[model samples]
Target: MVRSSAPLRRLGAELRRLREATGRTQADVGEAIGRSHTTLVNWERGKNKLSKSDLVCLLAELRVPADVRKGLELLRAEAGTGTSPWAVYGLPDWLRPLISFEEDATSVTTFQPVIIPGLLQTEDYARASHATAPQLAAPDNIERWVAARMRRQQRPRNDPHFRLHAVISEAALHLYVGGVAVMAEQLRQLVKATETDNITIRVLPSSRGDHAGVANNFTVLHFANPSADPPLGYFDGPLGGHMVSDAGDVAAMVTMFDDLRAAALAESESASLLAAILEEYQ
Candidate 1:
């Protein structure tokens, strides 16, 4: 298992929170753990990982409960490897940030009016879609990109905090990306994925005309921190991508998402829509 930077960062944050809850200064904690305050600061910043012994000592000094200790250990387990297939093939710089956020998100809500969201795409659908992109069409690169997308499924399955909700436009079901056979498989996968407790798929019918999100596709990522200023928003672009972290921008996008979800079909209705589309292919 390759550890991601996100887990380490989250661990650092939890450690800081624990220290604060205990009303102990970094200097005080460091003294108890036999480390310098600067070293403790670096660990809390996620700039470096604390040794196992050091972590044990710090936890003991901070009076961290068993549950918190278990949580930190889980995060440490996730911090082992950083390189994914996407990183290995040098995916675009802008995409790397999205990948990191995707890895860490507690909940992901997406509105995709144009096509199937990447995380839900089947391998064949992903390949065909990527092959059509002018900048990403290189035969070799398309395979790598598709592989990277498939790897994202690992997060939802393995990470307890991860949850995905995608509201797809009806047009995405109508458009045959790879071919009839490929689309059939893709739809089948979508149905299967929806069965997972952590995933939800909803369809926004075309009949809901001229809605708030007709012109854009965006994803909102919520973290575990309720008091965090705002969730992250990601929008795709013709050339690259855009990330919105500013409070105002993210707030507006989130409002739009709420509206989109309201206008979308209920979960059962969405499943029926998918089934109806699949029947057509059959």
Candidate 2:
């Protein structure tokens, strides 16, 4: 797979926006030119740049207006432009794409089975979440990860257009990670999140056993522009996590989310549940 860069990603975002406006699926475009779906997805993700002929073919298939074609041509010519700070931070290689995609997302949805989602975790909670691993215990590395988490978190807070909907398993509420006091503080922080209009949290009760999310955590990031950039699905892998763009994979992840959501308490109900759990620690 081709690595994504800032410039190409921007171009892909543009193409995605245009294509969606015309109601053409990635498969629709790829199949027209005998390109694989993976290749089409990669191009839309800015991971791969399409050649002039390919771009022309795509533009023609999308039935782009003559007036708009010139602007797209300019964008295509500069698609391979931009760098990111992911390299400077020395974060894991597999993580860079996720970080980039998340930052640009219009909305994000996450489902976590055993712990608070990193974006919503308190600093101490985040530390405890990772403290279980000896490899991450060193002060410097812990700080690095925490710092990265902090930076990643700023998007939803700072960007008014960005939204987050996270579904958390009830199992995480009972864990004594970093002790009851830490859990208490973390729960308190969760309550504060409800105050934000753009953020919504749901808790999946333990009673709803054997669900699709029993396997692993996943995040779905939606873009405002479906043509320039489409929604992306992410899941953990052996190294870090993998990004899913293929229609089938992304659809499966969405289905998993729907299942998790069905079993989860609504935002208001989850807040009440969280408040009840907080009292136990006190």
Give TM per candidate.
0.71, 0.75
RMSD per model, one decimal? 7.6, 6.5
Question: Which residue pairs come into collision in candidate 2?
Answer: 7-81, 13-228, 14-228, 15-227, 16-226, 16-227, 16-228, 17-227, 17-228
Note the Cα lDDT for every prediction shown: 0.81, 0.81
Model 2 is weakest, by summed lDDT over 10 consecutive residues, at 79-88
Q: Write the per-residue lDDT of candidate 2 for residues 66-92, one digit (tens) a residue.
A: 878887777766543345555456677
In the range 1-282, model 1's lDDT, one tens digit per residue, is: 654546666788789989999888999989887899988876775546676778888888888888889878877777774445456765776677688667767899999998899988988998888877756567767777778888887887677568898999999899989899999998998888778888889899999889988889999888776463237789986678877766789889889988888899998889888988888887
Q: Which TM-score value belongs to model 1? A: 0.71
